[model samples]
Target: MIIAVIDGMGGGIGAQIVSNLREELPTYIDIYALGTNSIATSSMMKSHANKGATGENAIITSVKKANIVVAPVSVVMPNSMMGEVTCGISTAVAECEALKVLLPIMPEDVEIVGLENKPLALLIKDCIKVIKKEFNIK
Candidate 1:
């Protein structure tokens, strides 16, 4: 299966997701790191993603082939990630055919109701649970 992990800024979140997936998921699964910049992509690449891409067009094109798209909710919000995420990138991710697994991370000036404030590690573990269930992984 193909999984895409999308992130921007420092790409710390994407890197962690990639590392967790590599450690827990089967080796046959393909993990793609899609970042808004080269620095972000490089960080995730160090986590051992099978492939990595950066920039708006790269994200738009790569997500199309993903079986699963994992990212923070900000990825679908235009002008998010301190303006690193463009309208085209947000539109592409929001409209992609892949099953989306978004973490409930709110950006500045945004608030999501009905979600408890959880630690980042806990949220990431929850993400892994969803991935495992979706793919029927042991």
Candidate 2:
């Protein structure tokens, strides 16, 4: 399966996701790191994503080919990530047929009720759990 992990800013979250997926998933599963900037892509690559790309076009094009798309909730919000996520990027992700596994992290002004306040690491673990179950990893 091809999984695209999308992130912006420092790409720390994407890198962590890639690293954990690399360690926990089967070797045949392909992980693609899609970033809003080159630094973000590079960081995820260092974490061992099978492939990496940067910019809105890259993300828009790549997510369509993935079986699963993983990202922070902010990724779907146009102009988020300090305007790094364009409308096209957000639309592409939203319209894609791939299953989406989005972290609960969001802008300060946005809130989703009934969600536990968890650390980033814990959220990622939970994200992985969902992916594993949805993909029937076991």
Candidate 3:
């Protein structure tokens, strides 16, 4: 399966997800870190993503062909890093046949992690669990 991990700036969101997936996912699944910038991709790459891509166009192109798209909550909101998400990533999500899993964060305009009180990583872990079960990523 092709899993796309997207992020904006520091890649903390994508990096964290990538790191966990690397440690927990079976070796057969493919992980791609899709970043809005080089810094984002590089950081997630260091976190052990199998591959990385940066820039809005590259991110869009990569995500378009992905089977699953995992992004931080920020990726759904407008930000300076990727020059607003509506026309880029948002459009891709609207058009592509990819399954998206968004993490919980500030501002509240995007999707929440939806769980009992827990840390972000743990919430994300649960998110991955659902994704794995749904897709049978093992």
Candidate 4:
């Protein structure tokens, strides 16, 4: 299965997710890093994603082949990530056929009610759990 981990800005979140997945999932599962910028892509690549791509077009095309897409909720918000997320990028991610595993994290201006505020590490752990369940991994 292909899991696309999308992130922008410093790509730290994506990197952490990719690293955890690499350690937890089977080698056969491919992790693709889809970053809004080259720096983000590089960060995720360093964390051992099977492949990496940058920018809106790359993200738009890559999500098609992914079985799962994991990212912060902001990924679906246009103009999020300090304006790194474009309308096309957000639309593509939201409309993709893959199962989306989005963290509750969002920009300061947007507030999602009724969701517990968890630390980044805890959120990522939850992400891994969901992915493991989907893949039927122990």
Candidate 5:
């Protein structure tokens, strides 16, 4: 299945998520990094996403192809620091057949949580475990 990880400018969160996802999911799962900017995309790319895309258009369009989407709690909002993402991204994410592994804060049924830094890693692992449980990976 195609899994996408989204982020903006800093990409720090995306980087960390990709790192953990790589170790947990391995090459069996196809992971894509959809960053709001080049910076975020590059950071995630370093962690070994199958491919990378950036900017508003790239971000929105890429999500359609993925079977799963991952993003920090931050990206859920409309007005990103880099620019505006409109409601389309959220709608696509909300409506997509792919399960989203969003982080920290989230809307009801969207799928998200807080993780990393000690217990943070544990939380992410649990989240991934849940993802694995729900889907047929490789």
Candidate 6:
């Protein structure tokens, strides 16, 4: 199965996700790192994503091939990530056929009601569980 991990800015979150997935998922599961900038992509690559791409067009194109997409909720919000995430990028991600697993990470000036304010590590672990369930990975 192919999974895409999308992120922006410094990509610390994506890096952690990639690292954890590398450890937990089977080697056959391909992880694609889609980043808003080169730095983010590089960070994820360091975490051992199978492949990576950067910028709007790259993200738009690569996300189409993924069976699942993992990203912060901000990835779908245009003008988020300090304006690194464009409308096209957001639209592409939202419109893609892949099942999306988004972290409830609130960006500046935005608030998501009813979600517990959990630590990022805990949230990432939950994301792994969702992936496991979706792929029926034991």
Q: Candidate 4 residues 14-114, lDDT tens each?
A: 99999998998899999999999999999999999999999999999999999999999999999999999999999999999999999998999999889
Segments of candidate 2 deviating more than 4 angstroms: none
Across 1-138, the per-residue lDDT of candidate 3 in tens digits comes to: 888988876888778889998888887778998887788889999998888887778877988778888875566665534464546766675567888787666454433565456687887888789788988766
Per-residue C-alpha lDDT of model 6 across residues 1-138, encoded as one tens digit per residue: 899999999999999999999999999999999999999999999999999999999999999999999999999999999999999999999999999999998688999888999999999999999999987998
> Hey, what RMSD does candidate 4 come out at?
0.7
lDDT of 3 at 57: 85
Q: On TM-score, who's better, 1 or 3? A: 1
Poorest stretch of ten by lDDT in candidate 5: 106-115
TM-score of each: 0.98, 0.97, 0.84, 0.97, 0.79, 0.98
Each model's total of backbone clashes: 0, 0, 0, 0, 2, 0
lDDT of 5 at 49: 87
lDDT of 5 by residue, 1-73 (tens): 7889988767877787788888888587788898877988999999898899987778778888887788865
Pairs with backbone N, CA or C atoms under 3 Å apart (clashes), candidate 6: none
- Residue 36 alpha-carbon offset, candidate 1, angstroms: 0.2
- For candidate 5, the lDDT comes to 0.74
Off by over 4 Å in 5: 81-84, 105-119, 136-138
**Model 4 regions lying over 4 Å from their true place:** none
Shift of residue 123 alpha carbon in model 4, Å: 0.5
Model 2: which residue pairs collide? none
Candidate 1 lDDT score relative to the true structure: 0.94
- Report the Cα lDDT for residue 18, model 4: 95
Better of 3 and 4 by lDDT: 4
